[model samples]
Target: MSKTVRIPRRSRAGILAAIILGICLLLLLTVGVLTVGAADAHPPRLVDNAGLLSQAEADSLRATLDQYSEELNFDIVVVTTNTLDGKTPRDYADDYFDYNGYGYGANRDGALFLRYINGSSKEVWLSTSGEGIKAIRDADIESIFDDMEDDIRANRYGAAFQIFAQDVRDEVLDYRSYDTIWIFVGLAVGLGVGLIATNAMRSSLKSVRQQRYAGSYIKGNSVNITEARDIFLYRTVSRVAKPKESSGGGSSTHTSSSGRSHGGGGRSM
Candidate 1:
């Protein structure tokens, strides 16, 4: 003989509610872990080591860099340090980018804008890797420095960084615009226009009138399709990525002190 033990309705309901609550809690925990991992995936774009800019300025600059980096597929970083800590400006910039986990792709494509503000040794340096190196040339970097060195020397850090960001964006865009597809497209369009114009001039000597509809000049009785149906065979959608422009060995580069290859230029402000 065995006793029949049964759970009450209220007890069963409480157990079910507890189980549902437990599942929900587990789901929330899982989502939280994923969120943290995603947030940790990327390093910050703007690191004001020397605290040159105010909080608002840093925030604004960081937002701009973030937007451009995503749009261009290359990280744009800016760092300001009081001193190089005994490293050359180039080495400091390169190592900072390499060690801090910046860059976008396998070659760690990124550009670093460094401002060293040590007394009597104020300097500006640009370090580029991968696509950034291909897009920004030494001469272009020098031109950027020339345009903003005065502001940097004047301790207008905010203004200088803004100018740097704008100039770099322009340079990268200009370089990427030189893809071969653009040239071929331009030539094709020009030839097509010329042919169309010549043909139109020749046709002007003949008689032709623009017809609005296919049935306008047709006899209705000649067409005798009694039934019509459209059958859908398939649907196809195609996508073509923009072609990446070749560097063509334009930019000069060298191995940084960190043993990573980089292209850039620097000058004392």
Candidate 2:
């Protein structure tokens, strides 16, 4: 026969409270770990997967990108990879961005520059999402690529990347200042209109003077009159067809492997 030992009422209550506290602490720790892990997985800017950059180079680039991205309220990502994992430059770039969750704001406004170096098939791909697509137009991107082409061809990888970053920063900033740009345009238009009106008024005054002179039917002391003559050596007329202004500008978009829409363009160097 065994006798059961009964715990005190206060002791049981204390034990229950201790267990509850322990569970709460465990839950908090798990949450903390998860949050940190997520942050680590998604770097805000540069992702040098190819291990091409030295530690110092990577750190500096990452720092610069962080500051620039924050200022623009957009994510500018640079990814370098030796192999595109059997995907084309554009597809890899888009998937890398979408999968890793890089971007800012609700629409994930961001841009990506992917350097794919697979033996002789090296290339750079630029992709944009959300507002980023609107910020950098296709023509603007081509121009930037042209600027970096020489550096890339010379194997100056770091310099080429830096140029890319700088150009993107400039283009994005210019896009943001559209309002100020429009203001300047408006002022220019107003000035042109004013000039045209003033010229017309001067022409009218000249016409009135001519009419007065015609009414006289005689030469004034200040005027020299000669026999009227018509010289028709040649008759010439000019016509200029107005240019059809293009209404198209901005990145061309497509659906990525991850099913997210992206705008981008790419070229080989």
TM values, all candidates = 0.68, 0.62
True-structure lDDT of candidate 1: 0.87
lDDT of 1 at 237: 100
Please give the distance, in angstroms, between residue 14's alpha carbon in candidate 1 and its true position after superposition: 9.1
Per-residue alpha-carbon lDDT of candidate 2 for residues 85-149, written as tens digits (9 for 90 to 100): 78899999998888887888888888899988877888899999988887888898899899999
lDDT of each: 0.87, 0.84
**RMSDs, each prediction?**
12.6, 13.4
Q: Please give the distance, in angstroms, between residue 17's alpha carbon in candidate 1 and its true position after superposition.
A: 8.8
Measured by TM-score, how close is model 1 to the native structure?
Answer: 0.68
Worst 10 residues of 2 by lDDT: 206-215
| Cα lDDT of model 1 by residue, 106-141, tens digit | 988889999888667788899999888878887788
Question: How many clashing pairs per prediction, in order?
Answer: 0, 0
Best by lDDT, which number?
Answer: 1
